[model samples]
Structures are given as structure tokens and as C-alpha cells.
Target: MKVIAFGASTSSTSINKALATYTAGLVDGAEVKVLNISDYSVPMFSEDLEKEIGQAEGAQAFLRDLADADALVISYAEHNGHYPAAFKNLFDWATRIDREVFKNKPAVYLSTSPGPGGAQSVLAAAVGSAPFFAGNVKASLSVPNFYDVFDLEAGQVKDDAVNAQLKEAVAKLA
Candidate 1:
């Protein structure tokens, strides 16, 4: 199966991106494509901006990437208990191009943060909103205290229980 994974953040060193990449690797036999949102940048969405610049090639490409995927593994980064501007902007542009931006593909949603809440607010928002855009969410996970639970050197979850839960969640993609 073709799996497209991305972190909903623009940070070059985004922990959510790391988590998405690692989780995508765990899906056995699936061809994975890890996308960086920064690579798909677009001007902040507005009716005026759309009228001035027209559709952006980058946004179209980003939508094409989602359209090509059979499954998705997305990890959300929270900014003040909500989605960062980078992700929100991309979503807005993609939504204009296609209302069902996720294309009804089964997805695994994940979130991690430096704090104990693990970006749960944004994760909840994603789960709640994804289906409206045709995101067939199959499972969701929240890894709290990201630095403590994730091992940067090892590029994996360090906590055994969290790792097991992550594995179980990814397995549902099949």
C-alpha cells in the first residue's frame, strides 16, 4: 500500500514530523512518503489573496500528494492548544481545491508535545474535523511529555507502553 505521512508543522526540526516518519516506517511492507509542509508553502488563504495570486502550484501539489495516498499517518504539532498556522494555511488552500481533501483514505492520527497534554487539543480538533474532509481516521495516539518518551538518538519511542500503543495504532492501518 502507498502511505503518505506528514507532520502538521513548519518547524525544520519538528518533533511531530519525527514521530510521523517513525510511525510510517513501522507499517510493514507499505511504501511510505514523508512530506514536509514547508515544502508546500502558500500565501495565507483569503478571498483577496486568491483573487490576486490565483491558485498556488505548491498547494495543488500538496493536494495531489494526498490524492495519491492509499493511507496516511499524520502527527499534529500544537501551538497554544491549536494547530500551527502552517498546517492551518495548507488545509485552507487544499479545502478550496477539494472539499474532501483527505479523499476518504484511512488515517492514523498522532500528536506529541513537550508538555503532559501531548497536544491533545489539536489532536481532538483533527479527529473532529478530519471526517468532514473525508479523512477516514482509523486510530489516534497522543504521546505526552515528548522529550521524555521519545528517544531522539534512537529515533523511536522510548517508553515501552507508548511504543506498544503506537505499534498497535499503526497496525490498524492494514
Candidate 2:
């Protein structure tokens, strides 16, 4: 399987990015491609901007990446209980190019945060919106208290329960 994983964040030290990368790596025998939201920078979407610029090369490339994937692993970072502006902007641009942005690709969705809520609000939002964009969500996982559960240097989940849940979720990808 060609698996594409990304954190819906632009932060240099995004816990969600680490989680996505770790989870994607767990899918046995799959070729994984990790994307950084900052690398696909598109001008913030607006009708006026669309009129001024027909389409952005960055957005086109981003969509092409999604199109090439057989499966997707996305971990969203919540900012103020919502998606970060960087991700939302890229999403908006991609959607304009094609309504079915996810291309019906099976996906494992995940989220994490420093707090107990574990960015669940944003995960819920993604779950609710994904179908419209043809995201075939197979499983979802949320890791609460990210700092306590994940070991950044080791690149693994330290909490047994969370680790088990993540394993089950990644299994669905296979």
C-alpha cells in the first residue's frame, strides 16, 4: 500500500506530526510518504483570491499527492478546539480544485494534544467533514496528554492503553 501521512499542522514541534509518522511506520510493508503542511503553502483561500489567482501550484501539488495515495494517515492538531489555520487553508484550496479531495482513500485519522481532551474536537470535525470529501475513514484514535503518553526521542507511544488503541487503528489500515 502507498500510505501518505501528514500532521494537520505547521508547527516545527508538532506532537501530532510525531504521532502520524509513528503510526504510519507501524503499517507493515506499506510505502509511507510524510507531508509537512508548511511545505505545501498556498495563499489563504477566498473568493477574491481565487479571482485574482486562478489556481495555486502548491495546492495542485498537494492534491496530486493525495491523489497518488492508496491510504492516508492524518493526525490533526487542534488550536482553540479547531483545525490550525495552515491546514484549513490547504484544505480549502484543495477542495476548490476538487470536492472529493480525499479521493475515496481509506484513512486512519488521529489526533493528540498536551491536554486531556486530546484534540478530540478537531478530530470530530474531521470525521464529520471527511465523508463529503471522500475520505474513507476506517479508524480514528486520539491520544490524550500527549507529552505523558508519547516518547519523542524513542518515537513511540509509552502508554500501554494508548499504544494498544493505536495498534488496532493501524491494523485497520492494513
Candidate 3:
């Protein structure tokens, strides 16, 4: 499968990105391309910015990525129990260009956090509405207490249970 994966967070050292990448690795014969939203720099979603900038080069490129992708793996970062402002802006910008960037494409929804809640709120928010926006939402997972379950330097999950569940989710999605 041609998988387009991305972390919803724009942080330079995003654990969510690591989780998405790790999940991509679990799929055999899958071609994975991970994206960083910060590189896109979509101007804060406002009609004013849209009219003035007419969409950033990055957003257009992102749309193209979605068009070519067979599947999407998104690991949403929780910002106060919601999507990061940057990712929300990107989603808004994408909708402006293509009402269905997803277009029923299979999606593996995921989230992770250092907190015990493990980005549950953000994942729920996305899974709840992503289908309305053309996502064939697949299995979901949230790694809780991220530091305890994932090793940043290794870029891998530490707990056996977490890894097992994640592997299962990836296999099902693939």
C-alpha cells in the first residue's frame, strides 16, 4: 500500500510522529512517507489568509500526497484535549481545496501522550468526525504515559502490550 502518514503535532520532537512512523513500519510491503505539518506552514485558516495567500505551497503539496495515497495514518496530538492549532489549520485548508482529500480512503487513527489519558480526547474527536470528511476510519490506538511506553531515542514502543496492540492495529489497517 502507498501510505501517507503524518503526526498532527508540529513539534520538532513529536512523539506522535514516532508512533505513526512505527505503525507504518509494521505493515509488510507498505510504502510509507511521513509528513511534518510544520513544513507546510499553512497560514492560520482564515478567509483573509486564504484570499491573500491563496493557499500555501505546502498545503497544495499535501493535497497531492492525499490524492496519491492508498491509505493514511494520522497520529493526532492533543492540545488541551483538542487538535493542535497547526493541524486544525491544515485540515481546514485541505477542505478548502478538496472537500474529500480522504475520500473514503482507509485510515488508521492513532494518538499518544505522556499523560495517562493518552490523547484520548483528541482521538475521539477525530474518529467521531473524520468519517464525515471521507475517512474510512480503521482501528484506533492510543499509547498512554508515552515516556513509559516509548523510548524516544529508539523510536520504538517499550511495552510489550502496547507494541502488540499497535502491531495488531497496523496489520488490520494494512
Candidate 4:
């Protein structure tokens, strides 16, 4: 399987990005492509901007990447209990080009945070609304207290129970 993975955040040191890349690596025998959303930067979305620049190249390119994927693993970073502004802006532009940005690919949604909330608010929203955007959600997980469960130096999940759950969730893609 060709799995495309990304963390929906623009932070250079985004923990969500690390989590997404690590989770994508769990898919046995799959070729994984991890994207850095900051690389596909687009100016904030607006009707006026859309009228001025039709479809932004960044959005189109991002959508094309999604089109090429057999499946996706996305980890969302929550800001004020919702999506980060950068991701939401890119998504808005992508939707203008292709409403089905996920391109009907099966997807696994993930989220995490240093706090106990686990960024569940955004994860739940992503999983819940995925179908409307042609995201075939196979499974979803929210890892709470990211710093505790993830070992930055080891570059993997350290908590056994969370690791097991992540493995199980990713396995559903098969």
C-alpha cells in the first residue's frame, strides 16, 4: 500500500507530526510518505483570494498527493479545541479545487497532546466529518499525555497499552 501521512500543523517541532510519522511506519510492508504541511503553505483562505488566484498551487499539489495515496494517516493538532489555523486554511483552499480532498482513500485519524485531553476534540471532529470529504475512516485514536507516551529520543510510542492500541488501529487498513 502507498500510505500518505501528515500532521495537520505548521509548527516546526510539532509533536503531532512525529506521532503521525511513527504511526505510519507501523503499517507492515507499506511504502509511507510523510508530508510536512508547512511545506505546502498557502495564504489564509478567502473568497477574494480565490477570485484573485483561482486554485492555489499549494492546495492543488496537496490534493494531488492525496489523490496518489492508497490510504492516509493523519494526525491533527488542536488549537483552542479545533484545527490549527494553518491546516484549516490549506484545507479550505484544497476543498475549493476538490471537495473530496481525501479522494475516497481509507484513512486512520490520530491526535495527541502533552495534556490529558489528548486533542480528542479535533480528532473526534476529523473522524466524524471525514465521510463528507470522502475520507473512509478505518480507525481513529487519541493519545493522551503525548510526552509520557512518546519517547522523543527513541522516536516511538513508549507506553505498551497505547502502542498496542495504535497497532490495532493501523491494522484495520488491511
Candidate number with greatest TM-score? 4
Which ten residues in a row are the worst by lDDT in model 4?
98-107
- Each model's TM-score, in the order given? 0.97, 0.97, 0.94, 0.98
Q: Please provide, for model 2 over 9-118, each residue's C-alpha lDDT reduced to its tens digit, 9 standing for 90 to 100.
A: 99999999999999998888999999998999798799999989988778899999988898999999999999999889988988898989998888999999999999
Give candidate 4 regions above 4 Å deviation: none
> Per-residue lDDT of 6-79 in model 3, one digit per residue for the tens?
89989989999999988887788999999888888666688988888886777788888788888888899999
Model 4: per-residue Cα lDDT over 7-64, one tens digit each: 9999988999999999999999999999999889688899998999899999989998
lDDT for each residue of candidate 1 in 1-174, tens digit (9 for 90 to 100) = 999999999998999999999999889999999999999979889989888888877789999998889999999999999999988998898888888999889899999999899999999999999878998999999889999988988888888898898889989999
Q: What is the C-alpha lDDT of each candidate?
A: 0.92, 0.92, 0.87, 0.93
Candidate 1 wrong stretches, greater than 4 Å: none
Model 2 residue 143 CA deviation in Å: 0.6
After superposing candidate 3 on the true structure, give the runs of residues whose Cα lies further than 4 Å from its correct spot. Answer: none
Ranking by TM-score: 4, 2, 1, 3
lDDT of 1 at 4: 97
**Which of the predicted structures, 2 or 4, would earn the higher TM-score when compared with the native?**
4
* Of candidates 2 and 1, the better by lDDT: 1
